[model samples]
Target: MPAPQFDPAAPLQFVVNAAAGSNAAASKREIIESVLQAQGRRGELAFCTPADLARVARVSAQKALSTRTAVVAVGGDGTLNTVAQAAHAAGCAMGVVPQGTFNYFARTHGIPADPAQAVRLLLHSVPAPVQVAGINDRLFLVNASLGLYPDLLEDREAYKARFGRSRWVAFVAACTTLLRAQRQWRLRIETGGTVRDVHTLTLFVGNNRLQLQQLGAEPEDTIAGTPGDGSMAALVLRPIGTLSMIGLMLHGAMGRLGEAAGVERFEFDHLVVRPTLPQGRRGVKVAFDGEVTTMRAPLDFRVLAKPLYLLGPQRSTATAEAVSRAEDAGA
Candidate 1:
């Protein structure tokens, strides 16, 4: 939509996931090579299994920095997140080609799933600033959560493995896991110069507006859209009975979660959460951008000041103006 800000002469480096099928990934690589060759450009491809994902990302990121090229991720949101962490640290422009169960990040940023079409768009794209949030030292592109939420992700993964990877399976697994909720964590949460101690089932943070809206969280009303604006939405679910939990799920399904009872939704520039963990437990389970991991107590979540340069569709001037208007109104 805007004038291209890309270097036509520079090569494109892609980090592809071969876990699903080496032959499939290889076919995509061939397509990418053909596209680039037709344009008289060069492109590099690094195929890696799940175990080799991180190492390949780091190497591709370093190559991106040295060569001043874009590091493209050719997989799902989790793979994109891993490559993004490397590209963000190296301060290189990044691109995406979605290939996951849910391509939340790519879809939010308007990146296509078709490899050739996505690469064609990349050639005409610019390195624009995109907002990124951090939990402790790790960056997350879509959403992050702890407590019952991470357990739900784990359960959903198990369901996906046994049944199949589909929206129905994920939704059923999530509803099942959510209905069985019996655990609650006592937490000290600090935000907006205020602190409170409360028991919550989960503390979920949202960065992408689409997912938040789907969950009936209109955080965009208060959270600024401009990059490095340091605004995010958080949802705190307190301990509730089974009936209330079922109603909460229905509200979320109906896109009215923000109005659901026993759920506290608010916007903040930064948040600090201290969870009470058992003795000798090194870290608490946390899930971000569809992947689960463990982090130590006192998980710090915040809007990162430094923006990640993303190569994709341009943000409309009207959208940018609306963000400014919203920020000013809040001020």
Candidate 2:
């Protein structure tokens, strides 16, 4: 891992999120005190409710504008996003202490979920400028989602809390929605200086590609993995009929999308999605990092390069080479 770029002697502000992954977020008082005592670093710890995150982040950023203080987010991706935005706005570096569901960024970056280790990293690790995205006026550290996935996130915690896993319930919900929901939007995607029109079930614009590949007669799915790179992927799923949807599920059981013709992948720095006809006039749901919001037809998605400082380990050289290849292709 790269060394922390900040001075070790600087004052640190630890922001703890108490409602991150579950019904309520966990408290970090014990861990915070322990880490502070262990490190002997003079720092102030602040517990933030969900309502206080934005305010605290903004305030921290403003203070950081003049003072050499580092702000740490002690929560999940959303919380980290808030902190990143504020820290970036304040022109200060931020660190993560992941304590939430689907700690995608943390997992990828090697930030430990353990509070003590996270604190150690925050104090010792170097902070580097990382990439972030902006949806309209809002900023996001990870990729954004548009379509069914965003809607699913509304109930993601509820369903996952009840089931302990997401796939089965998500698949069922998606199937049920597909059966009843009408898929009638036309999207004109412009990528790599080429324009293509497609009618699709859902559109995913992600900062990285996640791979969930397994060898079997069953379906193999992957998650996008590259969120920090200065690019995004567009996964367009073609609209299918009821029978086709059933076949798709069967293929998923076999570990692949049975009909793969319409699954087109596009990479671009900017995207403009325009509705085609009258039925397509119905707006789509767009989420900036899983928070759902309504967007009119012709949604525009763009990438903001190196929006904030992230402290994480570099992927292996081979992985870096492969990523370079992928970026070259996408470019």
Query: TM-score winner among the candidates?
Result: 1
Per-residue lDDT tens digits of candidate 1, residues 37-152? 77778888888897999899999988887887889998887899999999888888898887887565665676766788888888878788888999999999988999899999
Q: What is the lDDT of residue 238 in candidate 2?
A: 80
Where in model 2 is the C-alpha error above 4 Å? 1-5, 19-26, 161-181, 210-227, 246-261, 276-284, 295-298, 314-331
lDDT of each: 0.82, 0.63
RMSD of each: 5.3, 6.6
Off by over 4 Å in 1: 1-6, 19-21, 220-229, 317-331
- TM-score, per-candidate, Cα-based: 0.89, 0.76
